[model samples]
Target: MVLLEHPLHGAGGREAGPAAAGPGARGRGLVPGLSLSRSLSQQQQPRLGRRDFRLVSSLATTRKTAGRGWSIRALGHLAGARPRVGPARAVPSCMLGCAAAAAGTSSPPRCRSRALFRLTAVSDPECSGFWLKQSAYREQPTVRFRYEVLFVATLGPGPGSLLAWSTFPAFNRLQEDRLRVPLLSTREEDKNQDGKMDLLHFKLELPLQPTEHVVGVQLILLFSYHLYRMSTFVMQSMAFLQFFSPVPESQLSMNGDLKLNQRQLLHHCGLDTRYNVSVVNGTSPFASDYDLTNIIAAYWDRNVTTVFSDPNPLWMTGRATDAPFIINATIRYPVEVILYPLKTA
Candidate 1:
């Protein structure tokens, strides 16, 4: 889940314009090679089932708006088959009015025509679960089962997107396990008003295969921030795991009753070229158990020398167009003042 990025490329975007004006953005637009990094932290974020804000096509306006916003169509190779997408959709500016009215503001912000709605992601979208139904039950003699947990993501109103994620719960005949969630890429964001990117569009992978006739299971999702960690564990997936048994040890006893242990190792090879190559093999890492963690860690870790090549040369880019004020244009500070500095006259 190492999403290499430029500072302005984060969902926080450039801190200057109204469209991307938030607390987190420090630079205006993309600062070439200005890298923003997210780390694995000990502190955890809480995840329930439903903490998302859904975006609906505002019915107030007669003009069509539903099929205009962005939606995720491809979830990479790990998400199994791409879910059938219905239509492109977006929420309108009137959302501000409704939000204000609920807040007891004397007068709500008036809706505008040209540009509105800041695209946001919604978690646990029923459609994701429905796709699993099609994959699991619809196909007779189905061996593969897949489920998805959606999260509210913010596609930059002007630029950038922060992709947070949801959970995948799997159950079968009293057997259970968590599937691996792979993030091919991340769209960093600043969801909190604290002024930094705290959100991301983390495309995850949860694919499974059942060995028997499928029995329906209620999928429950909890929100989590650690994609790299949880995906590595891959605990409790019952659909594909018919049964799990631990390996037993045959001990060779020494004179003092001490035991010596030995195990077999598998050999492997992978894509060698750095980023210039088309595919970064084993780009996504997952751990099924402690041993798997070591294997995966060794695989993805640079300098392992056992499999992967050295770390790829980092590359970052920012959009050429500067994000402009789309919300309250009048309140915007001058671009020169925000992005440029003054010297003694």
Candidate 2:
């Protein structure tokens, strides 16, 4: 006579043999080939009855291969609704069945079936697996800056008694009478050869008349910043600096760091352009668009920004009559830690 048994224990159906009654036979706790049959008969029937039994039987009968076992494939089939083995990830379905069967539970099929569909992705075959609640990472961004300067050189002690110039065409147009174009030399350096810019050297030389003197200065620089690790983030940001003194100065030198200022959390994934707009509207001919007060106010409204932190500046008072007023600045960009949600499949 033939005895039908689960592949988990033995082959399809076969008669008992001498090897079945060997020394380890008792350790298996089975009487010849009738062990699995008796155990299944003793267990309580599931809600689906024979259907659940057939499902388990059919799932277990699939062809096996090397490097991989039957349990993982079976679980993936049931969870992903297909016979394809997915990513090297673990799910709760196969574990539930193994645990239920080992513990002699009343309903192993029912327990496993529920867990099989718990974390399944119906549409995406790649994203089918159980995973942790969340994850994060760190990143450093690539930054490129452009010169957008505005400086004031006073000639006398009155409101409109100063010479000024800016890179903005609109602002320079308004200051045509007092405007003086400066020769700007700017370059970005990657000290570590890591592809990301680390430092910016800015040097500007503004020619002056013999009697003209500079007692105050105001400057602004713009940057096109981007991030690519967690999400694609783009924005136009700026750094502004201003200082004035009663005594006239021949040169201004500054050294500072261009640091990130974030007031809100960034998105875990996808493109973000909330602060991507220009800091100053160069296209607009309106004087308000070029107003320093208006530009700074609009920039402060953003949740993310970059600031120039210069604690001490050097100002020299000795100038030859024919010499030009020089301004030298060094801005450094440092590495940063970013927290983002991890993707799973």
Candidate 3:
């Protein structure tokens, strides 16, 4: 068990000074109201080359003011975390509300809280393929002020929009990770003592893979405040295409009126699977954007293989490749992919 008198230490902010002790040694006791305490424990056996780690924790704090006592306890495990080594130690960025996503062969767990974010969109008849009309979130003006996002490689296809989500890297080399995003503004905030997180707005841009028509992309967001981190996997999508050979236009922009499955859309977003949402069936090229229409028709109207989105993007039941977010198409064709930025309502 890891114990610290200061909440900052919960995420390994300060090195283990002489005050550090093991489980049976001592656990930090709570103060009436003037101080902060946090406890984080790792349950997994140590592994050699690993960044992802699981933790089991039971946390509670008590304080008194004006002769009135108040306390809160958060038991059970927080979300799973990926670690980052700081100046002196290997620390797990405290993930408060994180959701599992599909990566390579493994499917990590996923979740939602006042601080968590979920995805939702529907097919459009008048625009490009689709538009995200809503994002699932709640408003909370509580919890202490906390937060960087670090970009690792361009996860295939190539350059696209960057996202800042639930948990971010606690300690990142600012020099190495560019894209200095300005302080973000959200519609809701967590300012009071409430443990709930406020709703936040998010935007995502997907990069395109050269020569490939029907591939998928993943969007992972990191949000770090003080010592707390929140990472949410927003999307793992199999996109339909509208190629721009000579005049490359926006990819997956909501300007096109395309339609897709609701459940698949929700699944790609790491949402609950029981949702009944619309899936992409076929294309009705917009009157404008003839170039885009022709491109979509060429592939969607052709003999291209039609695939479907997985009911859920979880590792066990879903594939990282495609179909976890799709449905049978109107015609077999390559779906041009585009990325959409999601906003809070």
- lDDT winner: 2
Q: By TM-score, how accurate is candidate 3? A: 0.16
- For model 2, the stretches where C-alpha displacement exceeds 4 angstroms are 1-137, 154-156, 339-345
lDDT of 1 by residue, 1-345 (tens): 111111111122222122222232222221111122111011100110111101111221312222222221211122222212223343232111222222343222221111112323334232132112111111011011122332222223322222222331221111222222323333444444444333223222222222111111111111111111111111111111011112211111111100111121111123222312211122333323212234335334432111111212121222123221010000100101001112223
Backbone clashes in candidate 2 total 0
lDDT of 3: 0.24
RMSD of each: 33.1, 12.6, 28.4
| Candidate 3 C-alpha lDDT tens digits along 1-345 | 222121212223332221332332222222111112232333121320132122212222211111111111222222344332222322222211111111121121222211112221223233222234534432111221122121222222444422112123321222234233322332323334255443233223322334223233222222211111111222112233211222222222211212232222221233322211112112323323222244335434422122222312211122233222221111111122322235445
lDDT of each: 0.20, 0.60, 0.24
Better of 2 and 3 by lDDT: 2
Backbone clash count for every predicted candidate, in the order shown? 23, 0, 58
Q: Tell me the TM-score of model 2.
A: 0.58
Taking the tens digit of each residue's C-alpha lDDT, what string does model 2 give over 129-243?
Answer: 3445454556667889866666666767888887877777877788878888888899999999998999899988989989888888878889888888878889888878777
